[model samples]
Target chain A: MSSQSFNRLTPYLFMAPAAIIMAIALFYPLLYMVFGSFRSWDPSQSLSETEFVGLANYIKLLGDEAFRESVSVTLTFAGTVVVAEMFIGVGLALMLDRNIRGMSLLRTLFILPMMIAPVVVGLVWRFMYHPTDGIFNRWLTQLGLPRVDWLGDHALMSVIIADIWQWTPFIFILSLAALQSLPRSALEAARIDGATGWQQIIHIKLPLMAPVLIVTCLLRLIDAFKVLEVILVMTEGGPGLSTEILALRISRTAQEFRELGEAAAMSNYLLLLLMVLTLGMFTFTRWQEARAQQLNKVKQEEG
Target chain B: MPKIRLDGLVKRYGAVEVLHNIDLTMEENEFTVLVGPSGCGKSTTLRMLAGLDIVSEGEIYMDDRPISRLEPKDRDLAMVFQDYALYPHMNVARNMSFALRLQKRPKEEIDLKVREVAKILGLTEYLNRKPGELSGGQRQRVAMGRALTRDAGTFLFDEPLSNLDAKLRGQMRAELALMRQRVQKNMVYVTHDQVEAMTLADRIVVMHGGYIQQQGTPEELFKRPVNKFVAGFLGSPPMNFMDVTLEETGEKFFARGDGFRIALPGRLADRARRVGQSELTMGIRPSDLNFDAAAPDSEAMDLRVSISEYIGAQSVLICKCGEATVTVEVKSETPIALGETLRFAVRPEGIQLFDKKTEDAL
Candidate 1:
């Protein structure tokens, strides 16, 4: 090749390794799962031995009671955890976003749960949520209250509580960073404009922070859908199909029932849901950007 | 409607004090400007007036009623910030109406007030535009309109025009001066630009090094600065200082430097005799020097022109009088060239004499 063509190909040459690695490590499994979703397969059968069952696995899941229950359960779990975590985390961030001695130490302590491994967080919460010997029940008994069945009757709530405990700090730190980075003079001007503390937050701080908060919420929503470890450790899809979210359901379908094709179909459904959510976030941000650009263009013409 | 007063006001951050024993009073319906260079405590003093900073030692009084402990809003004042702190999310109308909304004013009244102020600021066309969508000058006007819409008795400006480009700043400054005439509210403005102080201030308080160096009308500060700092600070291109020694040539007092000597005017000549200071610094503004080759040596300083800066209409010639550099503003049409020696007669009334030891006016 000529030197000019060689120069143009240099960037692609550098990217070739990462592209190959991604195809092997990521896209290969994805393609394999997608292909397997159209066949009747078992753990003992090879791909050659498996019979063609195009759309059967997906058709079966459409009417499956257990799969429907898991979808509902997954939505509820993800929605509740995200909503509760957002409220508590943003509240804590707003309350603590000020200069005070020991604030840095307090912030470090607050984000400690996020730093711990998710499995460790799961195990710790599982132990704490034990029926009678758990610290929570023990404390309730000491406080003259009846001990509640944490992981038995209230398995979904207990699982959600554990997940929220591990992840709220993620939102808290991001929200705090967003809050601290806001234009301080705007807040001061609000004060001069006769804004009370509450007024300042409502009128200036929250509106300015909405963009960051929306992105944070979307990120958390994505992670919440793929959440498997903490729930698996805490409830193991528990006491019924109550807390059997899509991830746990897929794992159980493949590992326990040995329905590899059905499990692949279920995994695709979950992936489809997450993809929609990711696309929704993208659309929302793009719309906002387009509106901003339009406004600027109009203003420029006027100027 | 209230007269504002700062009695021995002080500001301290931790163990270090910034403003010490500041005493000032702004009369009712007067425009008081606090002008100084950076780190000169002009902004700090204004912040204290706006209740944005703690009064470390003294109390602020309005209408003889103490307002040191009051919130900024309770002081019945509005402020324009240096950065034009408009709400990014709110449109110009909403930003201007924020204070009125907080007051729970009727919707009709709020709309009318916003419209009135917008019309005044020529922002009627841009009321629905958010700050981010507006240009810098528009955003600054929205900030000013936000303050104006409040109709507060006292309006405080903290370097509000400093963030604008030079041309825009001049435009806004003239607008502010026009506003000053239309509205008689007590206005306290802080700026490092002496031109702003001179043009807009009814009374100017010149500060330096966290202290009030001098306070008076703009002309009073310009014509009769109490100290060297004020004299050097209040003029454009600054006053030229040449160190000279006082020598008595018979009955006339002559200021004699390395390579030039000029007889002192009557006022300074009599004052120099009383000061009895052998060493002095003579200050003469570039505007006060006129080219007059035929003038007597005693009344003129012969300078060798080095570089002439052409600025249209008039040009400033950088000239040398021995070791000291002197600037003389001459008409652009004046026949002057580099490498030529010229005599510029000093205006008798324009010579400012200062004591070398104290830097105080003689």
Candidate 2:
């Protein structure tokens, strides 16, 4: 090969190892799952022994009330947790975005929950929601209030509160970073222009922080859809699939029900939802960048 | 218009004090310019008067009323910042009308005010564009327009034109002077540029190291600077200083230094004699030194020209006299050559003297 041709091929040669690894580590399992999603497979038999059952799993899930219930539960879990976490997290960030003694230490404490292992968080919250021996119920009993079934009748809501407790910190740290990086002089000018504290947040802070907050909320939403360990440990899809998100349902479909095809189909549905959110984030960022570039071009032309 | 007064105002950040007891009184409808070098507490004093900073020791009074405790909004004043602190998200009209909108003025009234200010600033065409869409000069105009729409009694500018290029700064300075004539309000502008202070000030307050060095009209500060620092600060190319001693040369008092001896201006001889200090430093402005080839030996100093900087109509020549380097501003057409010795007659009226030990004017 000529030197020019070799130079052109150098980049591809460098990328070849990563591409091959991706094919085996990522695309291979993805293709296997997609192919297996169309076959009626059993744990007792090899993949070659499985019979072709094209569209059977999807058709079965269409009218299955349990599958429909799990979908609704997943939507409720992701939606409620995301919306509530965003509000409370952003509100806390705005409130605490000031210099005080020990403020840095306090901010670190606020983000502690997001660093804990999800399984450990699940176990911790599960013990905290215990009926008779839990700290909350024990304290409530001492306060002369009656004991309530926190993880029984309110299993879905209980799991949601736990997830929020463990995940709001993620949104809190991101929102705080966005708030701190905002142009300070604009906010100071707002104050001099007679903006009240609340007015400054509404008019200056929130609008400038909207782009970052949107991306953070979308990222959290994508994560929220596939949440499993916390709810699985707390209720294990109990109380008639009240807290059973799609990820937990897929796990049970393969391990307990021995329906690998249905599990693969459910996983694909979750992946599709997350893909939409990721695409939305990418589009928003691209639009922002394009607008900034256009503004720069106009300024240069004017000059 | 309200008369503003800073009565014994001071500022301190923890243990370090940035502004000493500053007492200044601005008359109604007077334009006061504070000129000083960087870190000279001029901006801090302005911020204090604007209610953006807390007065550490004293209060600010307006028309004999203590208004230091009020919020900036309650103080009923307007300010233009150095960086043209326009809101990036808002267009020109919105940015200019923000204060009016905050006051909940009538929609028609806010529109009228914004339109009027924009028209005056020649920014009507760009009112719908964001600050990022405008040039730096246009952004500065919007900042000015924002301040003008307030209809306040007092206006404070903190180095409002310092961010622009040299040519644009000169243009804006002229525009600001024209605007000052039209607006009959108490104005206090801060700048470190001596030219800005000289051309635009009704009265100039020169500050140094948290202390007020001198405060007077431009001519007073230029002709009779109270000390050596003010003399060097207010002039371009700065005033030249040379170590000299006062000699009782028979009948005439002469400031005799190495390579030169000049008779003191007749009017200052008695004053210099009364000072009774032999050790003194002589000051001469660059503009006051004129080319005098036939000057008598006693009244002229021989300066060796080292470099000539051509700046349009005039050129500045850096020359050495004895051990001191002096800058001389001359017309570019003046016949001058490098490495040649020249004689410049010192104009007596432009000579100043300072005590060697204290640096105070004699």
Candidate 3:
């Protein structure tokens, strides 16, 4: 090749290793799953022995009531946890954003839950929710209140409580970072303009932090949708699918039911859902940028 | 219009006391400027009056009603910040109308007020634009527009023009002067720039080391500063300080130092003799020194010229008078060569003397 062509190819040559690793580590497995999703195969069978089913597994999942129930459970789980986390986290951030002694230590302690292993968090919470021996129930019994079922009749709530306990700190730290980075003078201006504390939060703090909160929400939602290990360790998708999320069910389908093709198809569905959510986040940020640019254009035109 | 008074106000952050007892009074609709160098507590005083900072001691009275404990909103004052803190999320009109909307004012009234203020500030064309989309000068106007729309009894400006570039600051200064005439409300502005204070203030308060050095009309502060700090602070090219000895020769009083000795005016001589301090600090404004080759030795001081900074009409000459340094503002076209020793006559009335130990006016 000519020197000019060689120079043009240099950037691509540098990217080749990363691109090849991605193809092997990421794209190849994804392609295998997509292709396997079209087939009906047992785990024991070789790939050549599997039969091409042509959307049979996907169609089966659509009609299956159990799969449909898990799908709805996943959506409700992701939506509720994200909404709850956003409110509590952002609220806590607004409260803790100040200069008191030991504030840095307190802030560090606040985000410690998110730093722990999810499985360990699940196990710790499982022990805490034990009907007779748990601290919560023991306190209830001592207080003359009836002992509440945590992992039994309220299995879904128990697992969700565990999930929120582990994840709320994730949202809190991000929201706090967002809150702290906001323009201080604008908030001061809000005060001078007669905005009370509550008004300052609503009008100045939240609106300024919307972009970060949106991105944070989408990130937590994406993670919540694919959650398995914590729910697996805490409730084990017990009490007949009450807390059986799509990811747990997908694991059961492949491992217990011996339906590898069906599991792949289910995983594809989860990926598709998360893809839509990420695209939504991307589009929202792009819209904000475009609006800002348009306003800038107006000013530039006048100049 | 209500008169404002800061009575024995003090501010202390933990063990470090920043402002001493500050007592000040402004007549109704008066424009008061607090001017000083950084860390002089001028901005702190303004913030206290704005209700942004809690008063560490004493009371701030408005029309004889103490307002120290009130929230900023309840204090009924508008402020223009140095950074021009317009809300980045809101458009110019929304930012300007924030105070009115917070009060649950009628939408029509808020819109009308915002529009009127925007037009006055030349921000009408940019009302729908976000602050992030506008240039620095435009954002400054939005901040001013926000304060104007409040129509509060008092306006507090904390170095509002300092953020702008030199050319824009000058233009905004002129606009502020024009606005001051039309707006009848009381205003307390703070800045480190003496020029802004001189031009904008109806009354200028010079501060140093957390104490009020002097407060008076700009002309009064310029002509008769009470101490070395005030005399040195309130001018473009600051006043030159010369360490001179007050010696009585026959019946005449002469301030003799380094290069030359010049006769003191009769009024200053009488005052200097009463306190009876031999060592004195003499102050001469840069503009007071005039080039005169044939001037008498007792009336003029000779300066060895070094550097001439040609700034338009006046060239500020950095010259040495004996061992003490001095700056002389003279016409740029003056035929004076570098390294040449020249005589510049000191006007009798322009001489100001202070006690060397106390730095107080003699």
Candidate 4:
């Protein structure tokens, strides 16, 4: 090869190793699942012995009532947890964005929950929600209130509370970062313009932080859709699939029911939902960039 | 309009105090410019007056009412920041009318006020454009328009034109002067540029090292500075200082230095005699030095011209006298040659003498 051609091929040569590793580690399993999703496969038989079912697994799962119930449960959990976390997280950020003694220590302590392992968080919460020995029920009994079922009848609510407890700090730290990076002089200008404290937040702080908050919300929504280990360890999707999200359902389909093809189909459905959310995030950032470019064009024309 | 007075105002951050016992009074409808170098606490003084910062030891009074404890909104003022801190999300009209909207004013009234200010600022055509779409000069106009629409009793500008380019800063400075004439409100502006302070101030306050060096009319501060820092800070080319000793020659006083001796005028000589200091520092402005060859030796200094900076109608010649460098400003038509000795006569009345140790004017 000529020197020019070798120079052109140098970057690709350097990238070849990582590319091959990604193909084997990531794409290989993805392609295997897509291939098995179209077959009637079983764990007992090798892949060569399975028969090509041609949409049979997908059609059956679509008609299954248990699968539909789990989809609704997943949607409800994602929606409630994201909305509740956004409000509580941003509220905490705004409240703690001032200068006081011990504020740095308090802020460090606020994000500790997000650093804990998900399974450990689940177990800790599971113990906390015990009916008789739990601190919540014990306090309720002491306050003359009835001891209520936590993981039994209200299993979905209990798991949602646990998920929010572990994830709200993620939103809190991000929102605080967005808050601290805002132009400080703008706030001082607002104060001189006669904006009260609440008025400053409603008009100045929130509007200026809109872009960061929107991207953070979309990212958290995508992550919330795939939550599994916390709920699995806390309630194990018990009491008739009340808290059984799609990830847990897919695992049960493959492991307990011995239906590998149906499990792959279920996993494909979850991937589709997450893909849409990721595309939404990508489009939002692209729109922001386009608007900025248009603004620069206007400025250049004026100049 | 009400007169504003800062009575012994002090500011401290932790154990470090940034402003020391500042006492100043601004009359009704006066334009006061606090001019200083960076970190001289001019901005801190303005922020304290605007109620953006707390007064550590003293109080602020407006028309005999103590207002140091009041919030910025209750103080009834507006400020223009250095970076033109307009709301990025709001367009020109909305940004200007934000204060009125916060007060829940009528829609028509807010619209009328915003349109009036926009027309004054020549921003009518771009009223719907956001701050991001505008250029630097346009953003500066929007910031000014935002303050104008509030119709507040006092206006504070904290280096509002410093962010613009040199040409744009001059244009905005002239516009600010025009606006000052049209509006009769009390205005307090802070800047580090001496030219802005000289041209736009009804009263100029010079500060250095967290202390007020001098405060007076522009001409008074220029011609009669109380100290050495004020003398050097208030001019474009800056006043030149030469170490000189006061010599007595039969009822006539002469400032004798290394290479030149200048006769003092009667008024200055009397002031120098009253101070009775032997070792003194002599000051002369660049504009006061005239290129004269036939002038007497005692009245002129022989300087070798080194570099000539031609700036349009006038030229500033950098020359060497003995070991000290002196700058002389003359007409561009003056015939001058480089590396040649020339005589530049000093104006007797322009001579200022300061005590060498205290740096205070005699």
Best by TM-score: 4
Clashes per model (N, Cα, C within 3 A)? 0, 0, 0, 0
Runs of candidate 4 exceeding 4 Å displacement: A301-303
- Expressed as tens digits, the lDDT of each residue in A1-303 for candidate 3 is 899999999999999999999999999999999989999979999767999999999999999999999998898888888888888888899899999999999988988988899899888988899989998999999999999999999988888877887788899999999989998888889999999899999999999999999999999999999999898998988889888999999999999999999999999999999999999999999998998789778678754
State the lDDT at A96 in candidate 4: 97
Residue pairs of candidate 2 with colliding backbone atoms: none
What interface RMSD does every candidate have? 2.0, 1.4, 2.2, 1.1
DockQ, in order, for the candidates? 0.58, 0.61, 0.62, 0.81
Q: How far is candidate 1 from the true structure (C-alpha RMSD, Å)?
A: 1.7
- Among these predictions, the greatest DockQ belongs to 4
* C-alpha positional error of residue A180 in candidate 3 after TM-score superposition, expressed in Å: 0.9
Residue range A1-303, candidate 4, lDDT tens digits: 999999999999999999999999999999999999988889998878999998999899999999999999999999999999999999999999999899999999989989999999999998999999998899999999999899999999999998888889999999999999999999999999999989999999999899999999999899988999999999888878999999999999999999999999899989999999999999999999999999889989976
Misplaced by over 4 Å in model 3 are A1-17, A289-303
- Which of candidates 1 and 2 is the stronger one according to DockQ? 2
- Candidate 2 deviant stretches above 4 angstroms: none
Q: What tens-digit string does per-residue lDDT give for candidate 4 at B60-83?
A: 999999999999999989899999
Q: Rank the candidates by DockQ, best first.
A: 4, 3, 2, 1
State every prediction's TM-score relative to the real structure.
Answer: 0.97, 0.97, 0.96, 0.98
lDDT of 2 by residue, A1-303 (tens): 899999999999999999999999999999889888898988887878898999998889878899899999999999999999999999999989998989999999999998998889889988999999998899999999998788989888889999899989888999999999998767767777888888889888998899999999999999999898888888899887888889989999999999998888888888888899999999999999999998998889876
